[model samples]
Structures are given as C-alpha cells and as structure tokens.
Target: MLNAITITQIYVPDQDQALDFYVGKLGFEVTNDMQFGPMRWLTVALPGQPDRALLLEKPGPPSMSEETAAQVRELITKGAAGGHLFFRCDDAYKTHAELKAKGVEITEEPVDQPYGIDFGLRDPFGNHIRIAQMKLG
Candidate 1:
C-alpha cells in the first residue's frame, strides 16, 4: 500500500535563493543537505509536518525543448501552479502583513472564501503557489 507522496521536485536556477524562500520566508524545516559531484540534494519540510517535503534542485540541460524549458521556467518564475500549502493561523490579515514585512512577495491579497482565507504569491523562482488558512464552522 502506498502510504503517501514524500517529496516534490522544484527546478530552480539558484539553490540558495530557493532555500531562503522555503526556509526564511515560509518557515519550513530543513531536512538534509547532500552534495555529490555536480548534484546537490536539499530537502525541507514544514514545522511539525514531515509527510511532505520540497525538493530544490537544478533543472535539466537548457538544451531541452524550448516548450519544456518554457514550462519549467514558468514554474520557476511564477511559482508552482499546483503547489498550495495550508497554514493554521489565528489571523490571515496578520499573516499577510508579516510576510510583507519579510519582503515576501504578495501576488494576491487575502480574500474570504467558503472554506477559508486564500491568498498567495511567488518565490523569486516563480513557482505558482499559495498559502491558506481554513475557516471554522
């Protein structure tokens, strides 16, 4: 039986920059840093959360098809289109401000939703992304 998906791979141009975003801005816990030859394997997870992790690694040779390159670059540039992290918070308004104070980009402001508060932004690498805090009954 498959228990769960443990990690996700995100292609980035700069490993350090991505680390800063996932760690410094998003407050994810660092897991491992392994370097072998020209490859570096760094993984991080959210505090108190370990079932999933973010894999920061370089993309394939740029010589790949322009279309594929465009898609990867788009994922890197805008943030993961399908990446959504849920944060449990007391106040979404304060969370938004805190992120702004950290110089984190706020591509969209918080808006009330049937399920909760949803707003999100991109890391410097452009992974389509968001953070949400679900509302109560």
Candidate 2:
C-alpha cells in the first residue's frame, strides 16, 4: 500500500538555477544530488520533511519526443505547464515578506480567504507556489 507521496517532479530549463532558487531562496534542503545515467537525480525537501521531496527535472529526452519537449519548454517559459505547490506555514504574511525580501517574484500579496491567509509566488522557471496559514476555528 502506498503510505505517502515520496517525490513529485517539476520540470525546469536548468537544474543548477532551480537548485539555487530552491535551496538558496526558499530554504529547501538538498536530499539527493547524484547522476543517474543521462539524468541527474536532484531532489529537495523542506526543512524537517526529509521523507517528501521535489525532483527538479530538466526537459529533455527518454520520456517525451523532441517536439513535445520543446512544447513543454515553451509552456514552462510562459508559466502554463508546471503545476503549483501549496505550503502550510505558521504565518503566511511573514513568509511572504521573507520570500519577497529574498528576491522571490511574488505574484500576489497575502490575503485572507476561506482557507487562510495566503500569498503566491513563482519560481525562476515560472512554477507557482502558494504559502498559507490556516484559520483556526
């Protein structure tokens, strides 16, 4: 039986730059950094959550055709392909400020919603990220 999600992948144009953004800016810790044949197994995890990880993948061969890969690259560039990551934080406003100060491209300011106080930002490759603090009821 599947107990939990171990890894989820997000494609990027460059792994090194993604690594820098995730590790240097977002403060994700590097879990794995090894080469696996043609692909580099680069994964990052939020601090204290070592079991779950995000795989920073490059858009290229072995899985998709060249044409499809090209289209994916275009979509990612336009911020349409890569899906979003939602994170639960202690304080959404504070987190947003920290990320903004770190030069993260915040697309939305923190606002109260049905769920919580939330804000949005984008990774260098245009992947959307949401940080939220749930309302206690």
Candidate 3:
C-alpha cells in the first residue's frame, strides 16, 4: 500500500542553478547530491523534513531522447511544464516578506483566503510555487 510520498521530481534545465535557488533562496536543504553515470541525482527537502524530498532532475539522456529533452526544456522555460509546489508555513506574511527580501521573485502578494493566507511565486525554472499559512481546525 502506498502510505507516504517519498520523492517528487521536477525537471530543471540546470541542476546547479536549481540547487542554488532551492537552497540559497528558498531555504531548502540538500538531501542528496551524487552523480550516477551521465545523470546527476540531486534532491532537496525543507528543513526538518527529510522524509520527503524533491528531485531536481534534468530532462535529458537517460530519461528521454535529445529531441524530446529539447522540447521539454522549451516548455519548462515557458512555464508550461506544469511543475507546481505547495508549501505551508507558520506565517504567510512573514514568509512572503522574508522571501522577497532574499530577492526571490514574488508573483503575487499574500492575501487572505478561506483556508488562510497564501501567495504565489515562481522558481528560476518557471515552476509555480504557493506558500500558505492555513487555518487550523
């Protein structure tokens, strides 16, 4: 039975840049960084959450043909790759301000919702991310 999600993958054009953005900008910690033949396995997880990690994968070679990889890269750059991440924070306003101060792009300002406060942003690779401070039951 599938009990827990272990890892999720998002295609990135460059692993190093993605690493810097996810770690340096978003404050995610590196969970794994190793090379396997032509592929580099890189993963990052939020602090204190190593049970689930996000794989910063490059769409190429072992995964797909060069032609297909090129197409995927184009789609990713256009923000049409459909890569999205949703995160929960203790304080959405504070988190948004902190990320903005770090020079991370803020696509939307925090706004209150029925669920709580939330905002949207984009990763360097055009992946959409939303952070929220959810209301507790």
Candidate 4:
C-alpha cells in the first residue's frame, strides 16, 4: 500500500457466525472484538499474514452518516463491489482449481498480472475475495 495495510471493513449479519466461518473454516485469527454501546467492532487477521485486519460489523454507526450508511447498505445488498479483497495463496492455480472443484462460487479464472497471478471467489455474503500468488521477478 501507499502507507500500510490496515483493516479492510466488511459488514456481516452476525459477527459470531462470521468468526466461525472466517476463523474456524478459513483459519483467520480473531484480532479484536469489543463493544462500544450498541455497536461492536470486530476484526480478524490471518496468522501468516497479519499486516492487515478484516473488520466485521453490521450496518449503522455514529461514525457513518445515515446517508452514507444507507448507500453502503445498498451496495452490500446489491452485491456489486468495486473490486475484490484478496487473500494470499502459496499456489494460486492449484488453490483456485481446488476451490472450483469444491463448488465454491468463483467470479473469475486465474489471471496472470504483471506483479502476480490471481483468481476471484465470492463469499456467501457476496464479498469478492481474490487469491493470488506473487509472480517471480
């Protein structure tokens, strides 16, 4: 990043369920889960990759204006996001194949970029997740 990878926020219906899926299934670690009034701030980070954290929270917070929250909720409901939030993979090709074989909803096939190789997968919650491997220089 231009500075550093912080938390990539994701809105979820249930934070506990999200933790079960991302943490229990995908092997992410629970970094932060705390409450401040009616809202809770939850974050998860990968073990091997900890530079960034994933924020799991529901819609609505004093931080966001009602109009902005409404727009974000609309985007989340429509399932049309700007781009994907990627997950690093050791072998992008094989991982993509295995995921496809397991009936995971894949958005795109592997594409080789100048800096890396990656493929996109859609989570159950409509979050586009990219799995990439760095291309050798």
Identify the candidate with maximal TM-score: 3
Q: What is the descending TM-score order?
A: 3, 2, 1, 4
How many clashes in candidate 2? 0
Tens digit of per-residue lDDT, candidate 2, span 1-137 = 87999999898888999999999999999999998877788999999998999999888776677799898988988989956888899988888888989999999999999988999888998888888999999
lDDT for every model? Answer: 0.76, 0.90, 0.94, 0.76
Task: Estimate, for each residue in 55-95, the C-alpha lDDT of model 1 and write its tens digit.
Answer: 87666443456577667776656555444544567777888
Single out the weakest 10-residue window by summed lDDT for candidate 2: 57-66
Candidate 2 whole-model C-alpha lDDT, 0 to 1 = 0.90
Error of 3 at 44 (Å): 0.5
Clash counts for all predictions: 10, 0, 0, 0
Model 3, global lDDT: 0.94
Angstrom error at residue 18, model 3: 0.6
Per-residue error (Å), model 1, residue 79 = 5.6
Worst 10-residue lDDT window, candidate 3: 121-130
Stretches of model 3 off by over 4 angstroms after superposition = none
